[model samples]
Target: MTQQSATQGSTQAQQSTAATDAPLLDVDVRATFQEQFEALAASRGEVTALIDATDTSTFAQLEARTNQLARHFQERGAEVGDFVLISSRIGSLIMHAAIAAWKIGAVPMPVSDKLVQSELDAIVEVGSPALAVDTTDRALSVPRITDLSAADELSADPLPAVVSPQLKSPTSGGSTGRPKLIVSGAVGDPAAIAQLGRVMGVPENGVCLITAALYHNASFSDALAALTLGNTTVLMERFDPETTLVMIEKHRATWVYAVPAMMQRIWKLPDDVKFGYDLSSVETFFHVAAPCPQWLKRAWIDWLGADVIYELYGPTEGQAATALTGAEWLEHPGSVGTPKVGEVSIRDDDGNPVPVGETGEVWLRRGVGEPPSYHYLGAEAESAEDQWETVGDIGRVDEDGYLYLTDRRSDMLLVGGVNVYPAEVEAVSDMHPAVLASCCVGIPDEDLGSVPALIIETADGEVPGDFDGFLTEHLAKVKRPRHIVGTTRQLRDAAGKIRKREIKREFLEPTAQS
Candidate 1:
């Protein structure tokens, strides 16, 4: 069957299943976050709600702890809609704090716990959160609450359930520019949470695994969805490729979230070791945050059944989303799937819609009369008329309305009047057996205006001698890198996103004045 017809069939099946299986709860989308939790706890009180490698907490236990933390936050002068900056390593404690903030009607803004004081300061300067929770010894101007132990002395009795006006304020990865807060438009509501859980295919009372950092939007959302569905969520403090496989087997995880970087690492494992664990329990293996190389995606589909592999494409801003199963992806190869929630339009510089198969800036719009799903704190969104917004992504839709991404428009290289998208080059490079990770950036060239420069992270500390031959065979001559650099250091972040602009600066800084 064609991709479009197959997708439509799948949607109809899902809707039918949902109508039959899902309970008709009187869930209020406007209900407070705390109220939602209280309802969940009452229903799934004995179920294991959250699990780390070492510790597990039931829904009842988690709700009680969150209530205690809510009182602590209140004592620290955190009021409704107050942004609480949470800077701590991923653990059960961070989840408790986030829920506690929601309980007391405070917004949680999670930043990377490993960030230096300067990086923390920049985010604080922009967000100006009312309370700061950093286990580290950094002094801050805001009221500081160090660890979960601080709430140890507080009462565990349930506090008044309250809801924040804003659900969360997650920061961007700062790949292309400065880190900015993307505050969610929707408040903490039961209906919204349930809808997200359904959309992500999170099952009730099932086991879910999250390997990415809690600071990342994808991980955070996944965790929340799992918890909302009363699933047993296994939180990994940090991603270790081998450990990830072991955890899946140990926990019998039915659903897991990963990025392409993590997948590549696992794919590199010895065949015996990689296949040693029983991964048959996994029903949905969802990957997002960055593009998955075609080869990598195919390998995964081959390893796991196509029905178990799923891909999501969307920004954290929640404006729209597209998703596809591996079976559907095989039919539509590079497409990110048709829009599941909103409309996508490809437009030229003049703001006119382009023909099918023509590349242009990809703009997304929610249903008619829908407001922007998010607003920026440190930067404004790139928006045009009638709520059409682009996150600077460039892509095209085929005749079947399946969207295929090129690269970010800001990351495009102008090479002698020909456009070169770094993602295309990097995707090709990542296919090489020796390459662990790769990044492509545009470097200044006097003759051609600019040219592509490739930076590779090899499997070992050394690059293969025939690396150029691999590139020549994979990429066109114009798209080939003019300069190649290799390092053992990783190129992508935990979420598998590359900071091409930052990498380009390192090569350009010395000759910038010349």
Candidate 2:
């Protein structure tokens, strides 16, 4: 097994390399993947690597299974640098294939199995995979790796001892007008992986539970952190609040990584329900992907203690740029944390640095010597100014250098003269016991210019009837959503990201100038 010494020199050396230069830092990433998998198999032996309602695979068993499936993919005409479409219920097979695809220099395109056929068709059309491993026996001509492969009929090839590139594919957002694919050429950087492992405090013997969708970057990256950092991962097919609680105890999971929504769902579990399970083994509860409600943040701190919940903010385009410890969160209630070691700056529209307390667009330039390398499939004109790029989030930094994001600059609502961040209002509204979920948006109002309107999902247990009087107690007059709407209407994506433009069209489009 190849092991690079976990030293400061290695980390600095890794960080110094330009982002566009090497796919993986120093070591052979493919070899690293195989070695770690083998190590996991050796150490864990028969311990489960993944668990679902109908399946469970021990670490040793999963390694063997993945090896066999890797052979199948090779036999079915899959070659190095080909995209492999992975659309299946999240399980050991999908997890195994992701590693296998990486080993063969194939990029794993993990798509949601829950997506409508049209959406799947759209992705498959554009992703253009060499092989697709789908669970259902459909009419699609792509090669499929079935459950029978777990029996292990083939010997595993010695994974490459040199790093290779898997053309960086962007996460497509269909809701924001046209679907865009952000092509990032940089392969999985092992050094960055190691740094993240340090930030996550991943132990050599740790096991992580993935409660979020595998299609999302955070879930995939967190799972990889375990493998790359020499730890086992327990994959859950789908996030179930009760099942997640049960599995945390059943697997004796050490690290828990999930989105705030998933955590809130777990928080929704009755006190008696949580008491029935033993999750004492869990050491870190990490939250990322979406902006978490402050109330949910407080509740997590209250339930599991402050040290348990750590929040990180970053985008798929830039990777995780900032990490805030729980204690740091107390010092400043809204700050995300200081900029990452490789990151720099928050700037205004005129490209000038904003004052400490003034809100502006978050702009980041890679550390010295980092090169400019980003590709977009649909949008042609690229934005590159001396290796600096902004991800369109509006935020401000405090005197101490902590960053606080207001909202997506595009989504900010200008209410008369008072600029309002939808995220802040939504965060506060989400804390209400009667509210299952809430999305705050500004709607055109003659009286207040653009007034805050909240679309809410009412909790089943708490006030299932009236929302107005219940909302009054929790919100201030100005911040209180002037208009309240039910969430039953198609107002948000499956990920719970509010479709503000869609909602705005429903309410304001007709009145627009023709």
Candidate 3:
């Protein structure tokens, strides 16, 4: 079928199979994630529910595994409202463990599998989870499950359903110090989950592709939403530009979650290779987590039409969100779209509201009478007296009500009393063809107080000699980095986020000591 025709058909199917209207088994607000899975399993028994590199599993198989895992957690003395720390890599095992935690009325807190001992200890200290799921032999005060084999040994029979008070507890470090667990406020209610799916454009019974790491909030939430809709979810063990396209074609995925970095890699693929995949089945291509470059956004829109390309901007706290389609983006250019779920206001340092088109700290709050969406465990939230919270982001709202982000408040630099957003400088630096990645941070300057310094990862491992000239056209003198350090090492993490504070320390600490 033609691309347009396929999209139309997919949309119609999505409408007909809206999660609320579907004949799904009745589930209450107190119903566990396992109970929701069981209902889907009974109705969509033979349908493939999950796909990964190793193999595929049907809803029935997934349900059975979840039940066994739930029993294992219970046998280990896990109880309602407890937190289970999952430090394993992305796969069906971790997914099953999360559901199992929910089944026993416990929350699942996922930590990066690659975290070092020190990092792991810090998070464990903050979360104080009931149990830790890790393969490595690490002696700790808490009980540990070395592998899923322990759970596999248990019976696969169904367990009594019980929902946790919170759906999940995801970690976020922001730009400051240690990571904090942002515990979700709401429980795992099927109706609420369905409504979230509809808002996020996740089609019922559609194929959802996940390329981002499951540890990230967006990836985890989107995957769960897809599963909640009885949609087939394809999880990539790791993201490869070409492999992502291949999987989407193979699975005929209708919805997919991606971050800006992933999109850039795919867009950088060879023309012939990138165009070879049949991504016609995709109805909604959702991207979030990081700011997407204008060029990359336009390229994807050109490739997949404006209607299918979508972008979302929000924090994991769920206080507010903005969504923009490619068509709307074309008109607004860099805008991330208007506030959809909550109110957004720009405020100055004194907590006073800013006028339109002026940059300031972006604050968000839920609609009137709506309760706060999340609470932090390890760190305090930055909020005004009126309860509008700022996630340390800077942005401005246009006359048309669209929001355009500048940079993280922590990453802003003072150059001779003029503010410089690292994102602005980094965006220009990334436009250079030889630069693979760029990180801009503030460094101490005697004259200017602090000036921007750039760390660049070159594509060919050689610093471009003309880097200074490249920025002359795009940036003003104050906005351009005073120092351009080159390295073959990547500056951004897998999720396209740079630890600006960490990078700044690495650059400044040695100089200060000297």
Error of 2 at 379 (Å): 3.9
Backbone collision tally, model 1: 0
**Per-residue lDDT of 474-498 in model 3, one digit per residue for the tens?**
8999998877778787677766678
Q: After best superposition, candidate 1 residue 271: deviation in angstroms?
A: 1.3
Model 1 lDDT tens row, 327-371? 999999987877776667777777666666888888776644876
Model 1 off-target regions past 4 Å?
1-30, 507-514
The order by descending lDDT is 1, 3, 2
Q: Candidate 3: lDDT over CA atoms?
A: 0.78
Q: Pick the candidate with the highest TM-score.
A: 1
* lDDT for 225 (candidate 3): 74
List the candidate 2 regions with Cα displacement exceeding 4 Å.
1-30, 136-152, 156-162, 167-170, 182-185, 188-198, 372-374, 380-384, 447-449, 460-466, 469-478, 488-496, 499-514
lDDT of 2 by residue, 1-514 (tens): 2212112354323222122222223322224455666766777767666665567777777667766676777778888777787767755556777777765666677766766666666666666778887775443545655554542667754445323365335356654655555555456445545545555445555788877666665676567667655566777776678988888888788888777777776787788996688878878888776777776777777777777778777666652267677778888887777655346456666666555577777766545466434456555522345555667788876776677778998777777777787887777666665566667777777767787877666644333454666567766667677766664553334443566776767654554322
What's model 1's lDDT at 446? 91
lDDT of model 3, residue 197: 56
Candidate 2 lDDT: 0.64
